[model samples]
Target chain A: MRLIADLFLVVGAAFTLFGAIGLIRMPDVYNRIQAGTKAVTLGSLCLLIGIALLYPAWWSKLLVIGVLILITNPLGSSTIARALLKAGVKPWSKASVSQPGEADR
Target chain B: MTLTLLEIVALGLLGAAVLLSLLRLILGPTAPDRVVAADTLAVITTSGLVIIAALLGSPLYLDVALIYGTLAFVGVVAIARTIEGNG
Candidate 1:
């Protein structure tokens, strides 16, 4: 049981770290929001579960945290994305980029 | 005792998820993108903290995790409203 708990903690931390890296690497706002919403939400929930396992006494608290995370993380990301869209931030037209043509310049 | 295979696998999966999140955060192009990434990271942190506490057999950490998660949500909402109102 302790081993399982440890596994969860280490794994959860890795997920959080990965999310942070994504935050630093994604090419556009929408992509970042998508990545953040998916990866971090799952990662956090896993981590919390791991923690709960470690301290069975506080399993209730861990559950509360998990539920709160489930409710809020995606909602917040979506809200921000909506605001960004309203602000007229267009999505990336293509996966890659190119310089403006002389005709435009 | 040596780490079990199950533990290793769980850690690896969690790491993969974190890496994915990191990629999003780094490559995000706009302010709102970063904000979303931050919010996501906050949730991840809350979860990681709870797990760490559990691994250490510390019940007190669970309370912190609970409070942190709730507060992070509130923060996200406030930020979202601020951005929307400004725009």
Candidate 2:
């Protein structure tokens, strides 16, 4: 049980770290948000599960926390993305970047 | 008391991740970028709280984590709305 919990913690942290890296590396706001949402949600879930396994008595609370996270993470990310789009933020246009003359500049 | 190997490693990794997100929040180009970074920071903080709870063997911290999660979501939505310029 201890070993399993430790494994989950390590994996969750690694996922979270990668997610942060994606945030820094992504070209635009939308891509960064997408990276943040996907990684953080799953990372939190794993951490919660690890905690639940480590302390059996905390299963009920952990379950509720996990469910709340499962619901809210996506809602917030999507809402921000929608608001960005509505506010005139455009996704990166690869075509413009792909033009050799534009790239030269 | 000395920290366990697992605790040190976990805390180090989580801390690094949180710092990276904070860097984004600081240097992010646009308002939406900062919003995304802040949202991500809220989440990482929640999980980091849980990790602390586990390390200390305190269930009360779990409640705090729960409340923080709820607030973080609300804050994110509110920021998004504000960015949209809607009351």
Candidate 3:
């Protein structure tokens, strides 16, 4: 039990770290949202599972938090993307580089 | 409260994750970029709270994590709506 719990915690933390790295490295807001939402959602779920395993009695509350994250993370990302679109933010594209004015908007 | 080597490693990784997200929050070029970083930071924080709960062998912190996650989601939505400027 200890071994499995530890493994889950470590793997989850690693995934989270990668997500943050992606947030920093991605070129645009949309890409950053994608990376941050997907990776961190999964990482958080794993962390919750690990904690549940470590303390079996805490499973119910952990499950609540996990489900909350599972639902909200993607919803929040999509919401932000929609807002960005409505606010006139454009998605990044390689072709935009050739057209400097296009890149600005 | 002694931590196992694996737990220590996990905590360190989480710390590094938080720092990276904070850097993005600081350096993000646009408003949406910063919002995304903030949202990611909230999720990481929720998980970090759970890990801390495990470390301290206290179930109480899980409630804090739960509430924090819900509020963070609501806050993100509100910010998004503000950014949209239509509602």
Candidate 4:
């Protein structure tokens, strides 16, 4: 049982690491936001769940945390995206992808 | 033991999903893409919070997660409206 719990922890850590990587590796602001939000959300969830699983007695609380993550992740991303759009940020075009959009535009 | 394996797999899958979403973020051409990315991130965060709460044996964390989720959602809506209104 303890071994199993450890596995969850490892898995959670992997998720979080990837998420952080995605945040940096992805291209523009929009993409970055996507990477950051999705990766971090999942990563955090895994970490939390692993902790819960390791301590099965706290199943109820863990359940609550899971629900919260499911709800909030997308909401934050949308807010950020909307703010960017309002500021007049444009989307990537085929041409823009090959070369950074700002230079081409 | 089996349950542990399943949880690991779930985490892996969720991680992959986050990556897929990241692709959208990278390729997304507009501000909305990024906004969408952020939104997606918020969802993932909420999920993670619940998972940890269960693992750690604590219910108190749930309330904080719930509040955060609600606030984040409201924030997204507000940002969306602000963008549309300006446009």
Best by DockQ: 3
lDDT of 3 at A16: 95
User: What lDDT tens digits, residue by residue, belong to model 2 across residues B29-58?
Assistant: 887899999999999988888877877899
**lDDT, model 1, position B56:** 66
lDDT of 2 by residue, A1-105 (tens): 877887787778878888899899999998999899999889888888878878889999889988988899999999999888777777776554554422312
iRMS per model in Å: 3.7, 1.7, 1.4, 6.8
Off by over 4 Å in 2: A96-105, B1-6
lDDT of 3 at A96: 43
Give candidate 2's error at residue B33 in angstroms. 0.6
lDDT (0 to 1) per candidate = 0.68, 0.85, 0.89, 0.63
List pairs with backbone clashes in candidate 3. Answer: none
CAPRI tier of model 2 = medium
Estimate, for each residue in B1-87, the C-alpha lDDT of model 3 and write its tens digit: 676899789889999999999999998777778899999999999998888888888988989998999999999999999999952
Best by TM-score: 3
Q: Which of the numbered candidates is closest to the native, going by highest lDDT?
A: 3
Using DockQ, rank the candidates from best to worst: 3, 2, 1, 4
DockQ of 1: 0.43
User: What digit string (tens of lDDT, one per residue) describes model 1 on residues A1-105?
Assistant: 887776666666566656666666666777767766776777777677775675576767667777888888888888887776666666765534553531211
Task: Supply the TM-score of chain A against the true chain A for every candidate structure.
Answer: 0.85, 0.88, 0.89, 0.79
Each model's Cα RMSD: 5.9, 4.1, 3.2, 7.8
